[model samples]
Target: MVFFKKIVLMSAVLALAGLTGCATKSDKAGYAENVVYHVNDSVVAGAAMNNIKNHLNANPQAKIVLVTHGKGIDFLLEGAMDDKGNPYNVRVQELKAKGVTFDVCNNTLVGRKIDPKTVLPEAVIVPSGVAEVAKLQSQKNFAYVKP
Candidate 1:
C-alpha cells in the first residue's frame, strides 16, 4: 500500500508538471498575426468591439478590423445607444484612437434606408460588406471572425 501511494503521488506530480509546462508554452505562443471581426448584430457588434479592445490591450501590436454590414450598421448609427442608453460613438472613437478600423457597408446603408453621413465619423464606407470580407481575406490575408 505504501509503494502504491508513492506511485500514485508521483504520477499526479508529473501530470501537474506537464500541465504547467503546457500553460507556459501557450502563453509564450502569444497573439495571432492578424484578426478581423465581422459584426452583423447590434448586441453582438458591441461584444465583438469589446473583444477587439481586449485583444488590443493584451497584444498592443495586433491588427484588428471591424466590418459592419446589414443590421450591424445600426451599431454605428448616429446617436445610437446601448441597452443601457449609453452612446456607443464614444467607445468607437476610443477604439479608433487605438488604431482599430471600422468599415461600414454602403450596400447595407442603401438597403436599410440609412444615410452614410448618419454613421459615426470614424467609420469608413466600404463598397459592400460581403465583398469587403472577401477582399480582406484574399488581398490582405485577414482572418474572418464572425463574432
Candidate 2:
C-alpha cells in the first residue's frame, strides 16, 4: 500500500511538472500588448488593480497606463484610503515597479481642489484623463479597459 501511494504521488508530481512546462512555453517573450485602463469612478479601484496584476502576470511585457479622473483619482492620492481603510500606496508602488503608469487628470486636481503635492509619486499629471485615454487607444492602438 505504501509503495502504491508513493508511485501515485510521484506520478502526480510529474504530471504537474509537465503542465508547468507547457505553461512556461506559452509565457515566452511575445508581442507587447498596450492597454489603457480608464477609471472614472472610485468603485472599481480595487478591481482595476487586480485586473492590472493579472494582465501583467499573464503578459509581463504588456504596456499598461492607468488613467484616472474625478473620484477615481482617490486611489492615487498621497494619503488616500480605500473603503476597507487600506492605503493604496503599497499596491501602487508594486504595480509601478512592474511598469504600470498612473495618470491623474489635471482638471480633476484643480476642480477638486487637491494639491499637486498630494498626488502619489507613482502618478503623473496629465492635461485631461479622458483625452489621455482616447489618445492611447486611437494613436497607439492600446486596448481600452474600464475596470
Candidate 3:
C-alpha cells in the first residue's frame, strides 16, 4: 500500500510539472509576455511602479497593464504622493510614456465616494479592477504579477 501511494504521489507531481512547463512556454521569452500587475494597496504602489519600469527596461516590446483598486488607486490620482512626499505623477507619466497602461477601478471610486474627475487623465477607468485582471489573464494570456 505504501509503495502504491508513493507511485500515485509521484505521478501527480509529474503531471503538474508537465502542465506548468507547457504553460510557461506561451511566450518566446520571459519578459516578452503580456503582463498584468495587480495593485490593491497603496503601500506597495511605489514598488509596483519600479517593477513595471524594470520590466519595460528589460523588454521594451512587452505589453504591461497596471490594474488598481481600493487604496491602490490613490497613487494614480492627481497630486498623489508617497510617504516621503515624492510626487507619483512624475513616475506614472514616465511609465506611461514607455507604454505602460494604467487602469483604475470605477467600482472603487463609487464605493469610496471619490470623484471620477480627481483621477489622473492618464488612467483608464475600468468597471472593476479584479475583473480587468481576470480578463487580461484568461482571455489575453497576460502573465500576472503582484509586486
**Candidate 3 residues 13-115, lDDT tens each?**
9999998788644354444669999999989999999999988776778899999999999999988999999999989899999889999999999999999
Weakest ten-residue segment in model 3 by summed lDDT: 23-32
Compute each candidate's TM-score over C-alphas: 0.77, 0.79, 0.79
Pick out the ten consecutive residues of candidate 1 with the lowest summed lDDT.
24-33
Model 1 segments more than 4 A misplaced: 1-32
Better of 1 and 2 by TM-score: 2
For candidate 1, what is the TM-score?
0.77
* Model 1, span 92-118: residue lDDT tens: 999999888999999999988888889
lDDT per model vs. reference: 0.86, 0.91, 0.92
Itemize residue pairs with steric clashes in candidate 2: none
Task: At residue 52, give the lDDT of candidate 1.
Answer: 90
